[model samples]
Target chain A: MPDTGTNDMTEILQTPLHDLHVELGAKMTPFAGYDMPLQYEGIMAEHNHTRQSAGLFDVSHMGQAHYTGDEAALEKLITADLAALKPGEQKYTLLLNDEGGIRDDLMVSRPFGEDGLYIVVNAATKAADFAHMASNTAGVGELRIIEDRALIALQGPAAADVFGALLPAAAEMVFMQCGVFDLEGVELYVSRSGYTGEDGYEISIPAANAEAVARKILGDDRAKPIGLGARDSLRLEAGLCLYGHDMDENRTPVEATLMWAIAKPRRERLDFPGAARVMQMFADKPARKRIGFTMSGAPAREGAEIVKDGKTIGVVTSGGFGPTIGGPVGMAYVDLEYAVADTEFEILLRGKARPAKVTKMPFVEHRFYRG
Target chain B: MSVKFTKDHEWVKVDGDEATVGITAYAADQLGDVVFVELPDVGKSFEPGDEMAVVESVKAASEVYAPVSGEVVAVNDVLEGEPQKVNESADGDGWFVKLKLSDKSQLDGLMDEAAYKAHIS
Candidate 1:
């Protein structure tokens, strides 16, 4: 089963678009302390709809912050080389604890003509993540959590066309580029980036105007409001990691197969948090490595055990039906020996051992638009 | 033949000692897009409340329970290839199994069509 990452202790929060989701007949579920839409029509239909056109996602539960400080203060905590980040460019990076374990995965961008770096972190880790950044960056710079904004992602093939019709200049931005634009007098910080491996833009809008902008976008024939259900499947098919599942505080970037996200300069400098241990892991190779696999029969879900010859070697972290591939696809952290493509294994589901094999990810190929 | 429903959302159609079983439309609608179904083997005996089958949607897997004690006599092989049948016609062609009832008195404990509808509503 897909983990909703629901935190029950906190009072459930609602996004600005919560009413719109309810009006659209969404089945709401508690997720990361917020009541969010799980699906609209159905997961299969919405999953297929997004692969064909555009799907709007309310990612407002995610934490967004602005940092104006010495770049070194922030760079020390993450794996990215902030000094090398150019205006209008974004980098996927990881925040690490002292031991080199990933605290959370996030996006850091330099909005075009903006004074400070713009960062986005996962919802479940936001509170602690913000506190960590605030405490660490004390006096060197300021970390301002942007509570007045709401983030929305318009993803899939037709996203550009649907969103571009509103702001012509946005269509010109390539993948990983960020810019500030005006939409009917509302300022939007938009980045050509998304969790789905589709060509898309993540728009940060003022909370008060979010519903109006979302309604206007959904007015187009190519766009529909997608929920967390399809969002999980889409990202799984694209081989994107979901924080708190695929990787958490226990796994380092090296073990999660996210070494590419660590910039070359940062690697050479070895200045980022846990750099020594992470680099050492890079050299010695981690005992366990993340891998992707496809299998027939029932989908193996998170916490499912993976075995090789009756010996447990790994555990599934993310899994479900890949509507695009028409079969089961999942990710697991397995013994380094079993992480190779074509390495056969068995996944234990309900006490039955179903045959599986490690396969290269993007179980469906990524279609990011790079200009 | 008389139709009975279980609180777990399965429906049983009794004809003498044999009964046909499937999830109710309300259950199927709540599941949304059934993608896989694991039926029990024919001849397997099950007690009431036993997990007789597993129905998987794109999002989750749910166990279908035996409302009355029985031995599986025949399984719906079509669901193996087209599980969406559960969503399309959950009460008809999507029927899960044919059970040889072990206790006819168990049928009396289940709800009738009207009672089942009222229970769901």
Candidate 2:
């Protein structure tokens, strides 16, 4: 919607570092309207490199937006009860349609001093998210979408060290804490948060500076530009959900195992959009809960059916082989009765029921650095 | 000793009565990142072509078929925790299983390395 297209008329969008990716011999694929790298040095190799050291991700496709207004007016719009959040804290929230379905899942951060609130949403849903947010707000806060920023994440065990060497200001920022800084004359909003199960940093900088910054980080032998393939696997290993796959408008926060993101103040007041249905779900305890499973014969992918006693009960949301866990792992919505740990179920794969069991998430242990 | 390949892209390096089995480099590349591999139990017996292992990538899962009829005598336990080895060196170090040839004549059915390459090409 913001004219993020290339000069070519193919309608296939390209990231700011498209040339860089090509130079690195990356295999590119169309994702979220952008022609993104699927892998470089191969997906398996990149995945192992990230788990063992550090890997760079070009996530410029994610959307960046801001909310500006007085407290009362701002509170009237956003579903999250933001007034309750302390400065420097970030909360995961969602935009909702009138029917109480989620529009997109996002992270809202209360920047220091709180002149305004900053948030990021999924790239695939960003266009719709902006339109939905603009149309649904009750003339409260003026939503400003940042279309010129490029979002990139450097993830894995050696992320901190990589950032410490390249950008000292980013090294000092604690996990979930973000601040503005100048990197070689380029101003960037740096935060220590990532979907990968590794200690990492997410940097938001002007689109013009993306290629140079990416080059600087990738100059290190320990850092490689990972593609969407490894990104999905890393997040899967971390037990993080992919918005359109693991969650959508039809899914509720509670049913998605993201109830922790809902705040107590909002729950008590039930003041935001979709409060009635979400609150009722909170009270009644949804009939189904998202649970992790380990497939036996083969991997169960998204939309695969989950069966119990030969009856279809749920569907697989995100399924893939977990590198860290050394097996095929996935998350699915199953009957509350079969959501507990160690509950045996069958995943329908290629018309065959593969033996599987509900296991505790994440499939692998997370290594986020709080310091 | 010579190597032969199956239609599913698995390869077997046969030496007299013994054979070493693994997937081809092309197959590994197609699978994307090799996160996990479930190998058949040791001592399992199978014919010329059988599903002896399952390889899972971040993208999908595929079966590793036996190129020659044999009895599985050993499996690569290292794959249990380091499946990436398969992608890193699918032919050299990523061998998945070792088999005791039940019928050495079965090796004639699989394609040679050059033939396998041509098939993939």
Candidate 3:
């Protein structure tokens, strides 16, 4: 039973393919407005399966939007300096609130031509992204929200071989590049980027072909349908943030340990929204920074408080069993002193403090296909 | 002979002075894939309901409790590397610990397979 006083099930939302998850014996739970599968065969199995083989993920709930303005004029609309975005190159960036808070972090890729651009935003913040983009596009040419498309990410070491055979062109695109291709008769915008620290591809196709194409990929002996449970763990192992959890409007990229997403030109020019505050933050050094840690006891779940020497310092954003690391791993914000790698702290798990230590991000090494 | 279960979902198969401990199949299924098992040191003694071992899955961690008061005589070393065997054969080959019972009277407090099933359902 759910915590009666805490969660309201009626307010929970369901995804477009909620029934399909049920049919596949997925254990469902509320996640970011959608009733998503926590696991199917199990989180550990699915996690390990994806690491050693291939795992099929249903990520259709993510927002897909396209911007069609003359490529030469696109640089003026986005917060990032899109003018420098060479065709086929992708960059991780964030849309900022006027006050310097992160509206959402996203992947922006210029597809075939300079005239058309595609962006993938977090599922929970898609509404705000659409609203922001819609308002901004009124002055530009046209901003089209591709609501009819679905995204499926096949992630793992074997992802290349599995996806390579299906779309030869896609297999050739190096990490952070995009290619338009077809798999099993369904056309898609396949990108060589993923949250898991593995060589993988995120394929965007028409919603009509979502299930059919997913089934076809899962038909491969190396691929097994994964669920949101392993998805969280996989990304955790890869040190990727889960938006609302690790970052939000109240957090800046620098504070979130995502300074790399900000370009040098933008940082120096201070042209983006909240640039003054972000620039100051970089100059002064943010007080609290996101850091990774490993818990010694029972998994320190979300909302667990972090303490050092009996005083509360921070709170865990995402914490749970990391199959790849073979222990409980999590991300949290702490006093800069405790954020150093190997700095010991304690996680208050169910009221009992357990020993924990700060560690480097990506508990598992990333394996992007730079080749 | 009697069987008892802890709320943590471990079971103790008691036969007089000997007790065999393992996680219930239901618990194993709910846990999904078992990646690693931290076995209690052999000869370690614990009472009923004490967390004796750690079971890790991809998403969470669970405690395997002692079903009855006893000293662990042996542990399933095979699980150190092949923890998935618990998901495959949780009842037999996946048995976690063999304890030399400290009190045989504890067996009377346990439930049979049918009763344990009803309790879980």
Candidate 4:
């Protein structure tokens, strides 16, 4: 029920696969600007099924756009190294504000045979992100938002096998590699990557063929339709952050513990947005850092306060019952002193302080392909 | 004794001064699966419309409000270990608590089975 809005439900947008989702009996809710599926089966069953087998998710709500022209031009406005990146490779990076706060975390991909780059950004900030890119990359590169395509993710251990069963060539692809493949004459822009820390693929298909491909994918014995409810839980268990909840316009990537996404060259040059302030944060160290923690009792939940020695030190950003962990797991921004793994703190839940311990993330170990 | 439902989806079955309380099947299905329930202890008193219990599904947490002013005389002990019973039998064995009504007149405000069925649709 993350941002399951209670306001007037008016003029909500629908994706290309909206009809299929409704036909499959999905519980639809307002997400971002679209009427998206929250669940097909129950959240628990769908969550466990994806972890054990394969889950098919309709991620078309996320914004996909292409920027054309000089690679160095758009690269200057964002964090990832487009010039250094090999064709068919996609890297996760942040779209930063002038103050260095993350506007959105996006995957910048350089498709083969093109000087322009394809980038996937978060759904909520797509408008703002497009505007930012259009203005900043005007002379160097031009941004073109892609709305005619639908994005679907086939995730879990069995995803590759299931996807390969449809397009045998897809099974041959390695991790993080992407390419355009003709599946029965319908073009599939596919990448071997996903949000669930599992072996999977995110396929960009034409809006007209989305329903047919999605149905075909779900036809596999291992693949089942999953919803946004399970998507959040799987990402949490994988230690991935949700925009607006985990980190936002107020916090820098350094403070969000996402310094790893910054390339070595970018760090060396230190010329990106708020580069000086971000570099200063590196030297001084962040006052608070995002940390994973486990707490007993009815989940610490989002907005629960973290306490140490009876003083508020932090707040839980994203949290819920981890079906895999069989316990409540959550992520929080905690004081630097308490960010260390195994450190004990108190999570204030329902007016009572419950015992909690900071731990290394991916509460469930990430099973992404190392190769 | 007759079953009555509140607009918030709570159902109450009244018998003399005692009443059985639980959520309707419509509410249970809407909530998906019940993983954990935090019902008030026996003997706890609540005014009409007061939140007296917490119900957690895998996706979210919700509050169960008191349909009518009453003192909880007994609670379903089975829900603690097997919360799925609510998903299985939302208005039957899954009753959250048995209440001793303090204001019997509050019953006038509740909807009958037909009206509840109509109200939900």
Top model number, DockQ: 1
Give the per-residue lDDT digits (tens) of candidate 4, residues A190-296.
98899988899999999999999999998898999999999998999999999999999999988899988878788889967888899899899999999999876
- Return the lDDT, model 4, position A313: 92
When candidate 1 is compared with the true two-chain complex, its DockQ is: 0.83
The most accurate candidate by lDDT is: 1
What C-alpha RMSD does candidate 2 show over the true interface residues after superposing them?
3.1
- A145-253 in candidate 3: lDDT tens per residue? 8888878899998888887877778778899988677666777988898988899989897878877777778778999888998899899989999898899889988
Ranking by DockQ: 1, 4, 2, 3
lDDT of 4: 0.89
Tell me, by TM-score, which candidate is best. 1
Identify the superior model by DockQ, candidate 1 or candidate 2.
1
Instruction: Give lDDT tens digits, candidate 1, residues A327-368.
Output: 999999999999999999999999999999998998988888
Error of 2 at A61 (Å): 0.8
Tens digits of per-residue lDDT, candidate 3, B15-117, equal 7688889998899888877777778899899998888888876666778878788999999999986888889998878999999998877666777777778
- lDDT against the true structure, each candidate: 0.94, 0.81, 0.82, 0.89
True contacts kept of 1: 0.65
Off by over 4 Å in 1: A1-9, A112-114
Ordering by lDDT: 1, 4, 3, 2
TM-scores of chain A in all candidate models: 0.97, 0.93, 0.93, 0.97
CA lDDT for candidate 2: 0.81
Instruction: Kindly indicate the candidate among 1 and 4 with the higher TM-score.
Output: 1
